[model samples]
Target: MSSKTGLLVITNPKQIGLVLSSVQQKVSKILYIQLLNALSDSASGVHTKIFSSIPKYSKEINGIYTQAARHCKHLDVRVLLSGMKHNLTKIKTQNPIDIVIFDKVFSQTEIDSFLSGKISTLTNNYKILTLNNTSEQNSEELVPEVSSEEEKRTFKHGVIGGTFDRLHIAHKLLLSELALRTDSKVTIGITDENMIQSKVLHELIQDLSTRIENVRNFISDICPDLQYDIVPISDPFGPSIVDPTMDMLIVSRETLRGGHKVNEVRDSKNLPKLYIHSVELIDEPERDPAEEVKISSSTMRMRLLGTLLKPVEINKNIPSKPYVIGLTGGIASGKSGVSHWLQELGGLIIDADKIAHGIYKCGKPCYDLLIQKFGEDIVGKDGEIDRKKLGAIVFKDRNELEKLNNTVWPEMLTEILKIVRNATEDVVVVDAAILLQAEWQHYCHEVWTTLVPKEEAVKRLVERNQLSEEQALLRIQAQPTNSSYAAAANVVFCTLWHKEYTRQQVQRAWNLLRERMCEDVLANCKNC
Candidate 1:
């Protein structure tokens, strides 16, 4: 196998026996089974049980994503199916398909017909590998039975709609069913703009172009002969309301009402009513127990917690050993819990809030400046700045809050930098709630931001801090939104669920960080 680029052809998905039980032993070893089994089982379910029990990657197989990596020391080659989430940067063609491993044996003519000009150009130099061996039996004793659930059906022109973010099993089941049922054309109206605003973690949804590209790619994979019309629609009625040519509307139980609504609108226009086919949304057992049993994009976004989201960046000026991590999040978003974990993992914690507390003491420079800006009355009779009194003066007025931040933030930054310069530990954690607002992310190697949804934050603030729900909500709203933090952060952490789940994410993130650091160190020493 050439790690740089080479195709692996497994002629029949059934040849793999639909097995992935050895998953814990070696992840890479199960790729064949996971990939092939998914293709094998995707055919039978009339949108119901087909993909319900299959590995997550089966749903993940929208395109020819392959790596012919064997005996490659530097590469781990693990495509662990974690919540439909992968590096978003790769959508920019950073990881173009070097190898395409397919289960079907194609005649040379059929293969030539399906290969796009771009794909052919990409692997034009490589040989078309057919790794078929006809030695095995035709008996059921030797090979497991393929699922008859992938039974095919057909419609002339069908339509479906969804956000399709981080496409998972449920999406694949619906799309595969549509592909199976449609004989001539498939029209997909992927939600975008205001239509997707109601989705959980909608900010993290893949862009319109990315979503459309993936849907098109998947349909092409399932049925290359059909003409596909994919569009970004802001409303529920894309072309279905007016398109008289449409024959059917593919929908899940949740979306069955929308299909009826489509027919209602069609009736008003005197257009022929398109038939509505409903499939049960796949109930995936692999998802987080804290999330809905029905697999969803929200769950996928949750799984990205405590993971390095952006690529590793090396500043030529900064030394690599004591990798500084800037951690921040909104109020009651479990930011402190994550910081404590990092401290336990050997990171020297630079508590920015504590620094602010120290600098707000009576004699501190920030204390003097804050009194000059707001009033001497902002300080307590005990000769220190009373946070409640100061908060009363600042929180009510935007200008006063700006003044307060302007006075304290620079002082906090100075103390944080001082500690960073003198730290002796191999890791430094800058725990700043205002890390982004203060522009302090520039000091660290990676910005790890935490989040708990606004509702959770409100509940925590109301119960723990004795604030009213309205007050808690206002406090949360005052801070940067989760999407804003995600945009700037290199890593994201969330403690919305139980602490054990949070631990798993943090542990994974730390392990990966150590590996990355080791690689950086090795690369630097290679020249020596």
Candidate 2:
């Protein structure tokens, strides 16, 4: 192939890098490749422009540009945003595109239109090439140890089991293979909490519902016609031991023993053994010369806890409205009263407790997770979470409380940020009992905590819930004190006085907030 300017047309962003690599190998010298795609616009007519930078396009196009830049770092690259009009002659005259490449197979009509002498001035000058269409069997052959023959075998009902925590590429590939091999249905058994405790960073394992939903969505995306059943498994065997109708069991190399155990258990039950289909484990290349051989969930979890997981980025550019405040206090510290006063003063309050309650409803992910972590006793007769039972379990043990916090706090922060982002009010208050403990103060401009004496809180609880003095005191002792709140608070409002006094304190805070808003507006004006 001659060294010439090339124009490549690709539909999928993922194919950009592969096409660029192929073209670079074929050409003798470095090629200047212009990636062309048309954007739909009603106002702009036939406007063809080149992007000078990668970040100036939509996210999808930007991803393609990034991939192309990485693959062709030593070569010249530009992206052309084509308009509706098929002005091939104008495009060729402006760019001197001597070689044209199509990443996808084109129909006869498309080929004729592109090579037509009436429209394209370079119909005779440019060399046109189309990418080779690779079959699924060829694609499977590219994987080192995977055989296309195994994937071609079909089963009536297939069984596969895993914790499926923090679903990654390996899990997706495994599920996709199972879905493709199963003709009627595939049973996916996600390990329950009991089985997941030995896994790395078990606290970060997603809830059962989340794992099931993720697997379902992934299989549907890969093989939409296949039917799948996702269920929680408390043991290694899962449904394979009991479901005599299952014809196949899919397992990784490491879990081949478990597959055999399932067959043994089935033999004892007088059921036929399942046909075991083993898949090779996917391994990552060694980062260091003396590194481990395999990549597993433990390694992924360690990476996530160490460096892969980053703190949520806060946007410094403030929206037009909503100066957010994080309100925190100990139990029975009168935060509700303070939030009420703020609402009366025209501040919109988002109650994190209310949001948590909604999240903990029966059939919700949190509810099921809580039940799995705790016991059936934590659920009431009506099948709802019994707050008293859960409180008793957690409030007495600090470690248990921390476990609960680790599970729920991230979700709470997400919802709180979403509410603040969409709030139309000038001031928005997030009232959460564990606001400082959860580190949600990062989402707010300021932290405001309510404080009341321990004795007063105990007395209020005794009167409010008709509890004995000793019981109320135990509840108060389990929580952080007023001094702890004051340590993390930007503003502390002592709520020991009457309702009017509490309202007055809120009024003063509101006045300060208004002043801050005015100062912000003035600073923005000065900058403008």
Candidate 3:
């Protein structure tokens, strides 16, 4: 009897050739390959190009498939494109599959789902094989470059603390050093949700359980023999301050001061000061020379957010009904008042900020991506995005704010364009504070910017938002200057003067906008 094997190739384009070759040697007869294409679902809205055709695959995947088809002529191969909702019954019934192969390790739930009904009854008869499809480029072993001279010393117990958001090379290096230096065991204190609120991209920080698991995994992968304890810490001093059993504390050079703070707290409690060992920060040779600062979780989050800078090129063939004007200004610069004045002038105003808020709501396209890029802490109990919580994270840091803009700007632009195309109005004003920063000038026929002096803007923010002078200054400083806005503006409205003066400026700009709109309509009609 010819033995048949059911191969479920959950592999990428690069690994398809190797997977087919390996499977051919194992199975003599029919090879059922269930190619998992994530683009089948609407959830993969970003990847619309991948699932538009039959036997859905990218150009690269198609090339691989063609090559595999030519090479594996002896083997009867049937390719089935699967989405999240997989069909297991039809494949088993038709082929009498004796063994199932998975390119990637499936979760217990997936395993259970795949091996349900009669297949579960005959446990020993059928076999499952998991193939590692990870490329050698990504699987390059990280050999520690740090000097191991001091790592010879052993301690009874050691404690280390950090946010450990995404376990990067630096994090792995730190954990490895701690494990090697410590004798019996090491205790790791991962910063909790409450504690990480002040951090840069705090919303992007992983949950306590995930962070702990990551730390545990790194420790296990590096030094499997080393006993370690991973705990969530609400404060800087988790168990280090209270626990007298810990003999030493390990920390990076940047966090060396924190180690001392722990010692101080221990000293105040009449406990002996723990020996502090500060590990030198590992250099990220992969990063650009300008960005070669200390390897940190903040930098990692920033890098992740940086990937979203360039959005997918969307269809720009919008209707000529609405002549869009991009309006922008600094904080407390009376840009909202300018927008209100424009609205009164019979222009349909589209608030990009409000649109952004709507897009951030639960079940929205940008919502889950935002949660993945930021974190769940930014989401409220009502399942809506907590703008105040989000603002708290981005407003303080310029880079963090830019990261946020990078993530949201593309989605916001796409939405704004969609709205503009469907509108019946002759004129539309897109009021966005980050209009210039987001490079939304492409969508508008003309750009208008409102300006106010730094000092006056600060004073208004303090009075309006009930914030202290320092807090108000921070908010003002975080935004682009009036000069920056003026550079991008076709019409610059100085809002420092009286309401009448601002209105006069708007009235003159409105007259010019009307003339331009007429010209645009005529141009579109001629083309049509």
> What lDDT would candidate 1 get against the real structure?
0.65
Model 1, range 1-528, lDDT digits (tens) per residue? 342532333323234322111111222221221222222222222111123232222323322121111122122222322112221111112133344443444566554543341132233444344334432343122223353443233468999888888666567667766765666788999888688766766656788999899777655543455688999988879898988899888888887888899999999999999878787665544556777776577887777776778886776666665789999999998989988888888789988889999999977888788888988888788989889888777667778888889888988888988888888998899999999988887778888988877888999999998989877776787779988998898888878789988887788788888888888789879978
Write model 3 residue lDDT over 1-528, tens digit each, in one string. 334655544445456667766666667765656444432432211112233221123232334444454455456554433331122222222445677776666675666555562132222577777777545342222223343444345577888888888776456556645654566778999888789867654544667889888777556543455578999888889999998889888888888898898888899999888888776664543453334476567666544321221222323654445777788988888989989999999888999989998888788888888788779999998988888888888888878787788888888888888888877888899999988778787777667787776778888988898888888888888877766776566676766666776776688778766776676669879999
Error of 3 at 469 (Å): 2.1
- The deviation in Å at residue 342 for candidate 2 is 0.8
TM-scores vs. true structure, each candidate: 0.76, 0.40, 0.38
Clash pairs detected, candidate 3:
203-374
Q: Write the per-residue lDDT of candidate 2 for residues 1-528, one digit (tens) a residue.
A: 564556665544445667777776544422433233333321122212432221222333434445544455444444433321222222333335576676666665665555452223343577777786522232211113333454446688998999887665456546645654567888999998788865644544667889888777556543455577889999888898999789899888888998899998999999999989776555543322222244456545433321112222344754546788888888788999999988988899999999888877897768888888888999998989998899889877888888778777777777778888888888999999888778777777777887766777888898898878887877777767665676566666756656765676688778766876797789889999
Q: Which ten residues in a row have the lowest lDDT in candidate 2?
A: 134-143
Off by over 4 Å in 3: 1-321, 519-528
